[model samples]
Target chain A: MIRTKDIFKSFDEKEVLKGITTEFYKGKTNLIIGRSGAGKTVLLKLLVGLLQPTSGEVWYDDTNFFSLNKKEVRAIRMQVGMLFQASALFDSMTVEENIRFPLDMFTNMTYKEKRKQVDSCLERVSLSGVNDSFPSEISGGMQKRVGIARAIVLNPRYLFCDEPNSGLDPKTSIVIDELILDITKEKNITTVINTHDMNSVMEIGENIILLYQGEIAWRGHRGEVLESDNEILQDFIFASPFLQRLRESALGK
Target chain B: MFLKNILYHFGRYVMMLGTAISRPEKVSMYYKETMRQMNDIGIGSLFIVGLIAIFIGAVTAVQFSYQLDGTLVPVYYIGYVVRDMTIIELAPTFTCLVLAGKVGSNIASEIGGMRQKEHIDAMEIMGVNTAAYLIMPKVIAALVVIPMLVAVGAFISIIGGYLASVPTGVMADADYIKGLRSFFDPFNVTMMFIKAVVFAFILTTVSCYQGYHVRGGSIELGQASTNAVVFSDILILVADYLLAVILTS
Candidate 1:
């Protein structure tokens, strides 16, 4: 579990996140949803200790994230896995090598053991038999799966995905969402995803926080979204006349 | 403002160097990375170094021969001048200047691209010290390999002088051979290696610094790469002067 206590972040003269306090429950998909400049990414970065909070505190379970020494922080980070928007797979490494990197760097496993672990990750992602393929040789959806495979290769206790479904078709986005949800449930991990994909918010958002102009404008589960009646949430999530009408019709109003 | 910017960058660069020299998380992983870098920086750079070395020697020999005409100096002094000049100056300075353009810019672009692509951040999130993993191997490889390349360049350049002068009959082969053996100072070779080692450090670290701290997008990346080459070349020339003074003194 991750908790932010009145977290605030700023860049120079501008503030991005203002006093965000929330808990991301373990074994659930907690999403931070916002418009382009609404500071979702900033919140995620602060949570992961990439950007320090200007004030307040971030706690990964019982440990204070910002107060730890370098070695201690690295120890915490070993249990943290992140999937970047661009996948961030090494261009020089094949899929197998990419998946094996964390093990190679941090484990005493032999080459055969490493290869077996890599193959297991590949199979978990339903991407078996592409071990030698470079990232450029794969499609965008496939790359996202590969990124997921690499992220979970170490079986992290906390998972952070930044816009995992971006640049994917709706069908592929659903696949990615289901994949994340499954992994979160199976691993019983704290999964925090920062995204603008409303489809994701509706599908896999077991818990969701909507940031508007650097503060939480709405907060609820996916089931509560359509009936919330929060003005900003309505304006942002159901902005389209078609969805607004569909919402009205579905509500039988 | 200018000096302030310079001091800021200088401090950051020095701090990065300190961070970059740390112990690796895994010794075998570092060993693998170092080997890859050795292959890339050493083996990948031979043809260009050899080609440039030959031309530099030919040009220096021809220019000195022309300048010596109708003078009191012997035509054979061309070989001695070319030999000493190549060893003491051109092989290290000119060769490193070329590498500052070729290898330095390449390192900067590679790292900068990784930064922009979020690869460095990914590694950092994995509990890896991105600076040490990415930059140390390159620095080690260049320090070891660049001096060896400079040595080869010096040897090849003397052969180039023999080719340029002996075939054209600017001096007798026997006289040129005598000049090569005459008053040869072993200290000059030491100076050459000293310059080579120093220049190698400047180019690798300066380039890595530019790349490691890059922000924004493609435009910033391009500027970082250009700055790496430009700063490395300028620093190399400055270090060459300082080394020349200290070593000779």
Candidate 2:
């Protein structure tokens, strides 16, 4: 579990996260949803210790991440996997090498063992025979799959995805969402995702926190989301014509 | 404000450098990084250095022959001039300029790209020493390879000067050999080696720093690459003059 207490982050004098506190639960898909520049990414980064909080504390389990030394922090980071918005695959490395990277750095596995592990990860992601292919050779969706494979290669306790479905078509986005959900459930990991996709929220959002500006505007389950009477959430959810029509039908108006 | 910012960053860079050195695992990573950088900068640069060495040697010989005509300057002194200039100045300074252009730009672009892609942050998260994993390798590689390149450049230039002199019929083979032998100075050679090492250190350090600290996005990375080469060239020229004045005087 990851918990933030009164987390405040600023660049120069412009506050990006404003004294926001939230808890990301274990064994479920915890979604932080907001429009662009709404501090969703900042919140994710802060949780992963990529950026330090200007004030307050980030706790990974029982230990305060901010209080740990560099060495201690790194140990915790090794157990946390992040899927970046861009996939962030090393362009120079082949698909197999990409998956094998974390293993190579962290594990003392032999060449054959690493290769076997890479193959297994590729199979899990439904990617095979593309081990030698560079990232540029693969499709965007395929690259995201590879990114997921790399992130999970170490079997991290916490999984964080930042706009994982960005730049993908709606269909591909659903596929990525399902994959994240399946992996989270299988591993029973604390999975936190930052996204603005409503379809993703409807599909796999077991727990949801909606951010407006730099504050959490609302928090609830997916079922509660469509039924919520909050004006801010209604404004956001009904902004989409499909959801607005659904709302009208459900309300009999 | 700009100066203060520069100073602040400079202090950060120094602290990072110190941190990289203090940790054993980081030092090991740094060693590996240095070897990789050496291979890229040193081994890959041989062709350009060779091409320049042969042409410069031939041209110097031709120029010396023209000037020596109808003068008391011994024709044999052409070889001595070429050997001294090639070893003590051209080999060290000119090769460094090429390195600054090629290797420096490459390092800057690579690190900038890594920063843009958030790989540096990834490394930090993984408990890897970013400087050791990134910067140390290049530094060590430059220190090792630059000196070797200087020696190769000096050797080629001497042979090239001899061939050029022979074809021009300005200096006899025996006289050229004698001049070369007489011009050899262990102290001057040591000075040249020292200069080469310093040049390598400055080039890699500045380029790496520029790339590692690149802000904004991919466009900023391109800007960092350009700035790295430009700043390194300026520093090399200044260092060259200072070293020359100090050594010769």
Candidate 3:
């Protein structure tokens, strides 16, 4: 589990995250949803220690993340995995090499053992037999799967995804979403996703927080989204007339 | 404001060097990366270095021959001039300036692209000391190979002077060889190596600093790469002057 205490972030005196305190549970898909420029990305970066909070504490399990020394910070980082919006795979490496990178860097595993682990991860993401292909040769959806394979190759206790489903079609988006959900449950890792995808929110969102102009406008599970009467939440979820009609039908209005 | 910016970059560059030279996580992996960089920096640069070196020596011989025309100075002085100039001034300084344009810009663009693509952040999050993993090998490769390139350039330049002067009947082959052998100071060779090593370090580190701190999109990346080359050239020239003063004094 990860928790943030009054997390505040600023850049050049423009406060982006204003006192966000939240808890993301283990073994669940925790989503931070907001419109553009709503501080979702900033807050997510702060949570991952990529950016320091202007003032607050990020507690990874029981330890304060910022208080750790360099060596200790690296120790914590070894247990973290992140999937970038662009997948962030090393362009020169093949899929197998990309997935095997963390293991090669951090483990004493033999070539055969690393190969076996790579195969298992490829199979887990249903990406077998394309191990030798470079990321440029794969489709966007396939690249996301490869990204997930690389992320989980280390078996990290915490997983962070930044807009994983962006640039994919609906069908591929659902597939990627289900893959992330399955991995979270199977590994029981603390999974945090920053996205504005409503489909993702309705489907895999176990704990969701909505940010509006650097403040938490609303927080709830997906099942409560249609029932909630919060003005901002309704304005956001039912922005489209089609979704508004669907909400009316679901609520028996 | 300008001074503040310089101090900021200077402090940051020094700190970056500190992290970049830390203990390696794995000796074999570092070795593998170092070898790849050696191949890239050495083999990839041979053709350009040799091409410039030959022309540099040829031009120096031809120009100096023209200057010595109708004068009491011996024709053999053309060879001597080419030898001493190539060793003490032209080889390390000229060759490294060209390399600062070629290899330095390339290093900046490569690292900047990776930074924009979040590859550096990914490596950092994976517990890799990104400064060390990405930079140490490049620095090592440059330090080791650049001096070797300078030595090769010096030898080829002497041959180039011979080719231009002797083949055209400007001077006899024996005269050129004798000029090369005359007034040969070993300290000049030491100065050449000293300049090469210092120039190599400056180019690699300065280019890396420009790339590593790059933010924003493609436009910013382009500026970073340009700054890398420009700053490296400026710094290499400055270092050359300082080393000349310090060593020759």
State the local distance difference test value for candidate 2.
0.86
Off by over 4 Å in 1: none
User: Ten consecutive residues with minimal summed lDDT in candidate 1 chain A?
Assistant: A44-53
DockQ comparison, 1 vs 2, better candidate: 1
Candidates 1 and 3: which is better by TM-score? 3
Tens digit per residue, CA lDDT, model 3, B15-97: 99999988887878888898998888889888899999999899999999999999999999999999999999999998899
Least accurate 10 contiguous residues by lDDT in model 1 chain B:
B37-46
Tens digits of per-residue lDDT, candidate 2, A1-253, equal: 9898998999998999988888889999999998789899999888888788899999889999999987788789889887888988889889998888777777878889999999988888889889999999999999999989888888899988999999999999999999999999999999999998888988899999988889989999888977788877788667878879998898788
User: Chain A only: TM-score of every candidate?
Assistant: 0.98, 0.97, 0.98
Pairs of residues clashing in candidate 2? B33-B137, B34-B137
Tell me which of candidates 2 and 3 scores higher on TM-score.
3
Question: What's the CA error at residue A244 for candidate 1, in Å?
Answer: 0.7
TM-score per candidate, chains pooled: 0.98, 0.94, 0.99
Q: How high is the DockQ of candidate 3?
A: 0.83
**Candidate 2 wrong stretches, greater than 4 Å:** A251-253, B19-36, B245-249
Question: Model 1 over residues B1-249: C-alpha lDDT tens digits?
Answer: 999999999999999998898989998998889898888888888889999999888888899999998999987798899899999999999889999999999999999999999999899899999999999999998999999999999989998888899998888998889889989989899889989999999999999999999999999999999999999999999999999889988
